[model samples]
Target: MARTPFDAGAEFDRQVRVLTDLGYPELSGLGPERFGALVAPLRARAMAAQESRYEPGAGAGDEGRVPFLLVVSRNVAPIEETMPRTVLHGGRLPGFVDRTFEPGSLERFVATEETLLPDPDAYLLFDIERGEEFCGVVPRDAMKAIAGRDRTLLTIEEGIALVTHFPQVLVKNKCFSLGGSRCGDRRVPAIWISQKAPKLGWCWEGNPHTWLGMASAGTRTGGVA
Candidate 1:
């Protein structure tokens, strides 16, 4: 599981580019330059980690190899607006919310109590796992399993950020759930490959899907965002 360390400064710049390409600036109404400024603290943090001789993704366990997930709050970049910009197949297919998910339907699916939003707009998340090993496990049980590992689930917005920055992670048969956000109902939000593209949808909490594993992260931290 060992690998060459990355240049954190370069990676942060790349992520800024990806966000610009994905229309985060416009979506959040910060425009490009302002949006970049808003997230500057994250860049500094990553660079500081490097100065300390610590690779951004380097930590104690195999899962620590997973780099930080930069998430913009749904409050800032509404999923209703951002989901459509999420593309697959080299931008050929744009993502969609399942028709069953009407406008405002996602509003109720707030982040769980265990989840932390270190910033009003954006923050950094560490130790993310797609939870592929939890495939076929009922989501309610999967939540327990993730907690047993001292992890919390990814929220719908966080899921989108991960897929937006790393689209290759959403391949067929490996999609994941966003159990961190819920509506007090039995539903669990998830993004999956649909019509050869990404689709934001939901699943019954008590049901198990052979293709769906709950995604999670270790914790969150505040940043310039």
Candidate 2:
């Protein structure tokens, strides 16, 4: 049987409605500026993570560079519920896996990352290295007990929407050198967001601490940028 065609815009709108129910007014209009505001912090954190991963005296540059954003989204359905039909490069693929997580050790490596299972059913991992991102959908009934209860700073819908929208802008802007060899290509800075706590928490775990130390060093030497 032929599969029904999926509409990206329509799907986005449906998710926007869900966001409305969750009290995200900004996403309704979802203008470039509004989208940028939501994405700025994530981008900053990704950059910081990259810097931290490479710290001072950690070689001149580009020793082990993995620059890319890992973006995850959660939903109240199976992983396929929100999986995008479009490819990372905006083309069709033979299968969903091809468009989502790259096949190989990279996928296995990503699965090993400390995963937090919060209420609601969705999570995403953005890979700055491969210049690709992956999405995971949690079972809808998985969070029935905590559905209305506010367990975290941001609701499930809000978190997913934020992660989802940000990458679109990043890709559109051509912020990172996605696919190539040199350090630039390998150097993909990434930010991983998931609902692990009561409030939105950001960390620079994957990258080295020296990069963050440098930022602090700069502040002491001068002032924040």
Candidate 3:
């Protein structure tokens, strides 16, 4: 039998159950507010890091050294109110917003430093896979400028394209679940993304048996057959 295509919503539910089992009570009822709360701290951290790295002495070199916060939420319905306040609070950061599933609108949100932020050193990617499907296209002119540059921390897919043609650089994949909710016995699959690697990984929680049985059993491949 052939493998099934990944269902973003179903995977989101699976992650919700994992959080519930881990005693995250709020995750059992995850809503927009809950998702916001989960991501706020991360946004703050990324912003603070960007501020720290910025210096007048660095000049144009500062452009390529900023870190980014990528957010991925699949099931939550898109609402203007659901837009992150943090982005607007201290001024918006150059990032993408995914409204791909919505009708009649552009699927992705692309912001350059001038349009979205005073400085485009860092990014806060909202809803990774959804953003990709919705608005992953970079304009041809922009692609021409940073074709083989190392300073840019492009999103996973973009990074893959750059790296495949130019294999001398490093790519990183930073994976984490944003938030989720459980329905029936199914847990929803949450969104995931990496800064460097092309692939994104998502799960409600780490598998219990894999950790407990394998580590405790003191074997490379643990558990009894």
Candidate 4:
């Protein structure tokens, strides 16, 4: 039998139905949703940045030459020398970034040197490296938690996890809070790096950085980007 061609539109509708049946709130939430508006621009920006770094017939080792963009508000201060170097990009960053990383102390989760920005209210972060592009936005509260060494919001591992698998972590939490059981007993949900979730492409959850009181691994004293 001939295989049916994959219809992106139809596949998208199916995913929508799955999340909708699970009582996804933003789908029925009120007010003009501005966060959802950032998806296209973010993806485009990520792709463009990646394309600019591409070299024809370059070997795999050349991948390291491609830099990741860590766009943020101009008002945001530069990362201090005392603090570990990490962009800590958050929000709906898609999973395609895994350039180079290693486990470290609580103070250094998803650590990467960031290129600061002057754009105000800049939330999305594009982890463009080679062909992978991940969407992310750092929550102000989480930043505060790291600064204040607040143990209540998130732990080092959780914080790292947040940076690693953003909107999914947010969505997974919401699902359980509303009695939805996609993640079973896990509150934040486990998203292994090797196993990528199907790209929903469209934004279903709002700014993940806006959510509050989320911590990982019982909290430890530290600060991050």
Which model scores highest in TM-score?
A: 1
TM-score of each: 0.89, 0.26, 0.23, 0.23
Candidate 4, superposed: residue stretches over 4 Å from native: 1-32, 54-115, 123-225
Residue pairs with backbone atoms closer than 3 Å in model 1 (clashes): none
True-vs-predicted CA distance for residue 201, candidate 4, Å: 32
The order of the candidates by TM-score, greatest first, is 1, 2, 3, 4
Backbone clashes for every candidate come to 0, 28, 18, 16
C-alpha local distance difference test of each model: 0.80, 0.25, 0.25, 0.26
Candidate 4 per-residue lDDT over residues 1-225, each given as its tens digit: 544433323322343243233332232342123323422244344344345543433322122121222222212222121012222224322343232322222123222122122233223322211111112323333334433542122222222223332233333212111101012211222122222321111112223422222222221111122
**Model 2 ranges off by over 4 Å:** 1-29, 55-66, 75-82, 88-114, 117-225
What are the root-mean-square deviations of the candidates from the true structure over C-alphas?
Answer: 3.3, 18.9, 21.0, 17.7
lDDT of 2: 0.25
True lDDT of residue 167, candidate 1: 74
lDDT of 1 by residue, 1-225 (tens): 766566767767877788888788998988988888888788777666457545544532243134666678876788888888787646578898898876677888898788867886888776677788878999999999888988878998888887877776776777899998989899999999998789999999999999998898877777743
